[model samples]
Target: MESLIAALTLVVVGYIAGSVKIINEGNEGIVERLGQYRRSLKPGLNFVIPVFDTVLVETTREQVLDTDPQQAITRDNVPLTVDAVMYWKILDVQKAYYGVEDLESALTNLVVTALRGEIGQMDLRETVSGRNKINQALLHQLDEATESWGVKIMRVEVQEIAPSKTMLESLELERAAESKRKAAMSETESMVESIQRISRALQGQPNSQAVLQYLVAQKYVEANLKLSESDNSKIIFMDPKALTETIGELISTDQAELGNGNGNNL
Candidate 1:
């Protein structure tokens, strides 16, 4: 009799212990009684009926979901691939357990659907440049959708937006062509301004020969300096005094012509 009593007591103790659950920190347990949700067990030592009560769900403190790159068409009719990641946390254990059949699958589908919708409304350039705006939009949409499911969307981040290599090359070539066109325009404008200035200077000159001789002398001096500094330079012997006297004579003749015209007018 003593042996039978001891065995029965041990069985009872084992059953009770198995029914009692200890939820770890940063975790929650959902209890179901007779196939129906009874209550959620918070982190600590808790007890339930041995045979009728069961743990319906267990949820983590936090969760992360990385979405694969998805190909989408933009509003401007450009195709692009976008990858993203999401952070979520379970807020209500009961809702998490019963609100959706599979949380991960639901979340994945929701993310893809939201991304496609947002991308479809934006052009490729806008999608790439306005990534933060897109992320915020996705997070808001996801949070609203997952509210009933007890999953709170903490953040959504766009990881990457990849354009085709051919598109990238085409963009680069267009930019290069634009830069070349601008450079050519600038050079042409500078040449036109130089010609205008030279024409104005020649128009007012009373002695064209004297001005031309002066310019020639200046150029000759510059060339002589450069040639003297170079290796294997030729020695061109030009009389500097004769050059100055010729310039003086040309200036005097121009002054005489001007004086004669003034006297006739008077």
Candidate 2:
């Protein structure tokens, strides 16, 4: 009789232990009875029918998912490597649990797809510089797509956007060429301006022709010295007299125009 009583007591204790569940804060539990849809369990102590109900607990707090680098191409056909992070949380544990087979995996694939699609619509420059726009676009797109999955996509961040090594080299070369072109243009403008100022200063002077010839000879020598200093430079020989004649012609035309204007004013 005593052995039977102790056995029954042990069975009762086991049943009570199995029925009582303590869920931690920031978490929720889903209870399914007989492998069918059942009510969810809130945080704190909960009770369930022993041996008939099974409980699955998950955190309701926010989660972070860091994706691996994904390869994508821009609208301009520039291949790029991209990666991102996502902040999310389970809003409906039941939906999150049942609406998707693998919630985390699904979210990752979705983010990657969206990333590639968004990047595909922009060029390389836009993709590199428009990170905030990309982030916002991804957030909105992911949030809408994940609504049914019972997950809230709080934020999306693009960590890196790197072009291919070949592309980077090409960009560097292009930039260097552009810089050289601009520098040449600036030098040409400066030379023209200096010539105009010198012409105005020598205008109407009695020895203007001598001054112009001397100035042209000095500039020609200076240019030759600079070209000689550069090992890679190809020195082009020109007649200094031709340059002097050109400047003389310009000065004469300007003086003529000035005299005509003065007569008109009178």
Candidate 3:
């Protein structure tokens, strides 16, 4: 009789020990009974039947996952590599355990597939410029799909987009050519403005010939002084026709002034 009592006590102790469950903070356990999902267990102490109940899965409070870069062709038929990361958490442990075989693998694959679809619908420029749009689209798609899986996608971020080396080089060359063309255009415009200013200045001056001759003489003298200071002293030469024209214009001015004086006296 004492032996039977001892055996029954031992069996009860074993069942109690096996039924006791302790879950840490930031984690949840999904319970299964007789090969069917029963209920989810929250953090801290809990209880379950030894042979009739089992923890099918345990889920964390939050999870971060980095996805590999996917090579995809854009709408413009340009191929690019895109990589991203995601933040997620299990809201329903029961669904998380039963809804998907491998949630992490499924989520990663889903993200890659959605990213490819998003990028494929955009041009290369749009894909590069519209990262926010792509992220939003991915979040929407992931949220919808993960609803059944009991995973909530907190955020999705594009880590990087790397174009091919050849494509990058071509884009850089195009930018450089555009900049060079703009610079050349600006210089030509400045030259045109300077020419126009000189033309207007010449037209405004009545003694334009004398003024120009004086400027030329001043430049010649400066050049001569510079040459004298150098080892190679050079004789500055003037065009004979230019000198003759300057002298003729000076004589014509004097004659006109004298004729005006004579007319006043008369």
Winning candidate number (lDDT): 2
1 or 2, which is superior by TM-score? 2
| Ranking, lDDT, top scorer first | 2, 1, 3
Q: How many clashes in each structure? A: 0, 0, 0
lDDT of 1 by residue, 93-184 (tens): 88888899999999999999999899999998799899999999999999999999988999999898877667778888789778856874
lDDT of 3 by residue, 1-266 (tens): 99999999999999999999998888888788998878888889999999999885476767899987788889998878899999999998877877899889999999999899998999998988999999899999999989999899999999888787778898897897788568747754764454344434564457865655565456556655755785634465668688657545654554566568779999
Quickly count the clashes in candidate 1: 0
Looking at candidate 2, what is the lDDT of residue 219?
Answer: 70
Kindly indicate the candidate among 2 and 3 with the higher TM-score.
Answer: 2
Q: Which one wins by TM-score: 1 or 3?
A: 1
Write candidate 2's Cα lDDT for 1-266 as tens digits.
99999999999999999999999999999998999868999999999998899999999999999999999999999999999999999999999999999999999999999999999999998998999999999999999999998999999999999998898999997997788668757865776567667767777778876876677667767867876896655677777678767777866776777789889999
Error (Å) of candidate 1 at residue 256 is 30
Q: Which stretches of candidate 3 lie over 4 Å from their true place?
A: 180-266
Error of 3 at 245 (Å): 30
